[model samples]
Target: MNVINKLKETAVSVFPVMVIVLLLGLTVVPLDKYLLIRFVFGGILLILGLTIFLVGIDLGIQPMGERCGAELTRKRSLSLLLICAFVIGFIVTAAEPDIQVFGSQVRGLFSFVNKNVFTFVIAAGVGIFITIGLLRTVLNISIKWVLFILYAILFGVMIFCPQSFIGIAFDSGGATTGPMTVPFIMALGLGVSSVRSDDENSFGLTGICSIGPIMAVLLYSLYLKSQGNFDSSSVVQISETAEAVAAGSPLSQIFGPFEEISGEVLRDSVISIMPLFGLFILFQAFLLKMTARQVAKIVIGFIYSFIGLTVFLIGVHGGFSQVGSELGFALGSKALSNGGIWFVLLIAVGLVFGAVIVCAEPAVWVLSEQVESVSGGTITRKLLLVFLAIGTAIAICLALIRSVAGFDLKWILIPGYGLSMLLMIFCPSMFSGIAFDSGGVASGPLTSTFVLSFTLGAACVGANGNDSFGVIALVAMMPLIAIQIMGIMFKLKQKKGGQK
Candidate 1:
């Protein structure tokens, strides 16, 4: 059953890209003889790996989140629970493979920055936001106030930071809350919500969990500006290699200069994960007094998560990153040759990415289901999916325009966020929660790996290096604007009906 579910997930995730490739037809493209082999093999590997990962997550991470959440509530001690929140936030984020992926890619873009420094900074940022999220949950804080404060700080930092760093900072914000962080954080939220008195309180955990990474990335942008080569610009290579260049096969690439460092990351992740496991075990044994079966199941799930995450990281670092960078560079180079060509290319790629995201985004299916359930059939999965596709397509269009036209990303984001916030003021609290949450969930792996690559590629060709960095950030930002617009509509609907 577990394997089957994962297979379904992988098929759902990878099918659109496969169809696109099939439609493109290998005969038309001019590339290496190994191109089809590389893509097919890579696709199969990803499907299996992601399948294995989801299964592992089902068996492990989810339970850990639930156990910890329940245990935190059981403790009934606010101080201890808050401390757990901080440690949990920091550890899980520190273990995040996505952060490392972004770090590696960003480091390659500029000669002056070190990957390790960037990785640590992004992780630290997650840690900070994780703490803030937990506090918000406890205090029952409105989402808008916190976002305003966070973005205000981000804007202030942008003023002092190198212009190049601003985009990277926002991009970092988007990446940090990816597949790894989302599941754990959402599960933790579910765990925390288990004890809540109200449905709204319990249900919005995933929504709140989304914001931490964005704020963290923005904060890190400040550091990138202060140290390192803020003045330097990365070359708009004719083709941007996907995040990592993947000079060779997985074994060769993973075992190279990274061999020494790989061990450290592995060790750190293990050390961090252990305490959480141990805590769960302790809670289960002492307080919950679970039978052997529950303990056994939780333990199995934990092991599964550990292994899946390891494989996921290996795949990401081994080749996926470079592929993203290379593909982006190529697309950007090709698209910018002429205005007519650029517009066509932008719309075409936008369609590809929009379709790809609906299937490949880990969070999209989850969010679709959430919407369906939350709206009690008013928002069917199909309806939610269609709207998301349309809205995301628009966002991609804007992002591409920013890339191709060299428009300030802030122009789009500032107004978009402003409108989202304004909606929050009048929208039903539930819609506001969902709107904020959608911001994080929309820009998942598909966005980071491909859509982001396409935007960066075009931006690098179309604008300055500083501008190239913000495409993903904008991709992450506009969804907040879009979903909230829907939220306002939904709130107004209730008001018209005279519902409480």
Candidate 2:
């Protein structure tokens, strides 16, 4: 699709969020003028960035990933394909903007760990899991069994890890599967799976790869604990503060957020694309040599992607996060004032916020559109979006509950994933993969930044520091069940039609 068309689509996704926040500010949680202005500008930036990013994915990243996957499969050398898969997965994930945000957050919380080292650990996990996913497709193994075994291992590791790390590990998994990584990885999966004449295997690689980070983080946490290096008291307090815009012309107030974030956003945007750019060049030279014209088109796409991603992150950080946090704090304080009776308000608002926010997630758009395309319209994008939104809403409610109640992460995640695994028995195979993949995509950059910041804001009201950490984790988990349930119904419908 053209950029204009993508812009309109993104506008529809983003404006609801702006409207909701505006209404909340006017009625229940009044935000100051400066913050609201920034939010409006942020929405505009989000629309523009998401539009350009989608176009770039179509023109550049998806094609390259698919071609690389297809070419590797055709080579008929398992060893080479596995090695390349690991390298691609590792580098691409390391460059993912979402992972960087997550790593930095963890680093900010615990100054003892270096952000680079933490990100490296997360990237290594992705690389190893990508290899396993590719191998599963090649060996024609059932994703259900693979998922079962992987989650079993995840839970086993979760037992010994510290409370602080549990949420971070799951959030890390979700973060790795963000805008930068989802399109390319999903395309790569399609490319590899296309080698087989079946559709079932095409949808699960992202799902499988998401598992890697969770495992890796959990193991790292366990190791930290074993060495007695973890100092729980050293963790920094999580809170949000909206600084005043610089005193100057009116234009300064309008442009404050953009100006504040430009430098870091530019640097991250460059870092985010470089690894993938280098990998694409390697593939072009070795595996999929194309004409000069094709090369130029891909290069143009990369440029678009870089610019789009930079603008998107700036918009999110500049506009959405502070507002979300402010609103959450307002609501949380109100809830507290009423002797905690206002917890219901948290659930209701969280549901609405979660529903709309997931739609704005760039990766959600990518995954939904890709699902429809890959399934030849059998599984509609609207269907995927609806299910994802529902799942995300439930997840937000759960996060808010934890924020107020201060429950253990195990109580929610363990049972939630257990149910997800059980649902796979009744779900169609393709849907199983799609559902798992949806979990990752549902909790993209917007969830990590906006939704998560909102949850943290509420948690801070009660001094529930650790409660907010797993919002992304819950956001990632719900889709596994939602999509699987949808898949079961779809399967039943097919059976009924056959009987008729």
- Please name the candidate that would achieve the greatest TM-score relative to the true structure: 2
lDDT string, candidate 2, 2-120, tens digits:
67778888999889889988998888777777788988998898889988988888889989988989999999999999999999888888887778777878888877777888999
What is the Cα-based TM-score of model 2? 0.96
Tell me the tens digit of each residue's lDDT in model 1 across 1-500: 45786587667767676556534434322333233334444555556666665665666666667667777776788787777677666665565666666777677666667787667666666666666666676677765677667666666656665555566777776676666567667666666666664335444444444455555555565565556545535432333333332477755444452453457646644654575576576667666577688778777866765665454444433334344444445555666665576467656766666656645565665556556654677757665555566667777787777766676666877777677667667766665656566666677765776567656655666664444576666666666666666767765776888964
Q: All models: lDDT? A: 0.61, 0.86
Worst 10 residues of 1 by lDDT: 27-36
True-vs-predicted CA distance for residue 96, candidate 2, Å: 2.3
Best by lDDT: 2
lDDT for model 2, please. 0.86
